[model samples]
Target: MATDGQILRLAQWLSPAYPVGAFAYSHGLESAVATGAVADGAALTDWLADILRFGAGRSDTIFLRAAYEAPPEDLPRIDALACAFQPSAERRTETTAQGAAFARVTAAVWPDDLPDFTYPVALGRAARLHDLPLGLTARLNLQAFLSNLVSAGIRLIPIGQTEGQRVLTALQPLCEEVAGLALTETLDDLAGTSFLADIASMTHETQYSRLFRT
Candidate 1:
């Protein structure tokens, strides 16, 4: 279980104001919107739900737990696997850059030796160092991840704020399921079957006019 202060720390780390530059990256959502694969709040919800269950959400949770449970000396191996799991150059940039930024900011404020690994790995290690509960950390991480993408959808789809919130609300159960499933899985199960999402990311790399980095 997590103490209130510990939970608050998780919220603080994943909050938009944390300066992870999350707003600048859409995780291929920009392309999905432009291509009309995600034109409305409902579509956005379904698309992001797939991503959470089969893509980065599932894999990152595994990596996060791997980092949390592993001997500290073995974190680099997990980080290597996380980096290698990315499907494209931009995808790699998205995770690694955010990871470095997250580690740098968190280390400065909390005074830890948090390494600049991929984002999930960095966050997992930080939560462990802070003595936060693993399940709560993973759950909130999934929520914050979905929340960020829904925010991106709000801007790209030009949906009303209420609709955006609704999309997020619709995703809550899926996030819970993925977070729960992730806790039961191991690194070997870190696989992504979201090929269309990966293609959207690759296509975004050369999109003529883009608003996101990946």
Candidate 2:
């Protein structure tokens, strides 16, 4: 179980106001919306579900878990794998940029020597460095990712705030389930199975009118 301070720290790190620049990236939902691939709340939920189960979300979970347990000497190799796993330039930029930004701020506040880490790698280091419980760390990170994506969906589609919240609420079980799986997974388990989501992220790069950097 997490203490109050641990919970607070994790919450602050994942908060929208944390300065990770998460708002600028929609995780490719913008392109999906533009192409009408995601037209409603149900579609949005299914899309995000696939992503949580088989896409970057799944990969990040493995990376996060591995980083949490990996020795300090192994982080670089892990970070390298994460960097190489990105399927597209924008996807790479999104993770690397956010990871770099996270490293910058946490360097001042949390003050770790995690050089050139991807977001999941950096987050794993932070979680371990701070001695946060692995279960809480996994669930919090997954929930934060889902929340950011849901916020994007609300803006891109006609989904109301309430509906978006509903989508998020519905995903909580899957989020925990993924988090649970990540606790036992290894980097070798890293696989992105949501081809459509990957394609949408690639397609987002050329979207004529775009609302997100990724």
Candidate 3:
């Protein structure tokens, strides 16, 4: 269990104002919207739910737990695997950029040897370093992840604020499920078959006019 102060601190670290530039990336939703694949709140909910269940979201939480328990010396290998796991150039850039930003900010605020690993790896290690509970960390991280993309959907698609909140509300359970799945998962379980989302991210690189980076 996490103490109230620990929860508060974790919230602060994952907050939208955390200087990680998470808001600037869409995790491929921008392309989904451009192609009309995600137009309304329900469609957006389906897209995010699939990602949370079978895509990068699942794999990231797995990596997060692997990082949290791995020996410190093993982090570089995990980080390398994470960077290699990105399916597209834009996806690679998005994770690494936010990761580097996360490292820089967290290093200033906490005693950290954090590196420029992908976002989940950096975050998992930081949470461990600060002694935050993995369950709460994963849940909140997953929520923040979904919320950021939902905000992007609001801007890129025709979704209204209430609609967006509905989407977020609909996806909350899956976030909890995925985060819970991360608790006992290992690197061997790391896989994401959300091909459409992957292609959306790849295709977004050439998208003529884009509001989000990935």
What does candidate 2's lDDT look like per residue over 17-48, in tens digits? 99989999988899899999999999999999
Expressed as tens digits, the lDDT of each residue in 1-214 for candidate 3 is 6799999989999999999999899999999999999998889999999999888888889888888888899999999999999999999998889889998899988759998888999999999999999888889999999999999999999779998999999898889888887677888878888999999999999999988889
Error of 1 at 92 (Å): 0.8
Clashing pairs in 3: none
**Which residue runs does candidate 1 get wrong by more than 4 Å?**
none
Off by over 4 Å in 3: none
Models sorted by lDDT, best on top = 1, 2, 3
Candidate 3: lDDT of 204? 95
Against the true structure, what is each candidate's TM-score? Answer: 0.98, 0.98, 0.98
Please give, for residues 1-214, the per-residue lDDT of candidate 1 as tens digits: 5788998999899999998898899999999889999888878888998899899999999999999998889999999999999998899999999999999999999799998999999999998999999999999999988888988888898798999999989889989999999999999887899988999999999999988898
Give the poorly placed runs of model 2, Cα more than 4 Å off. Answer: none
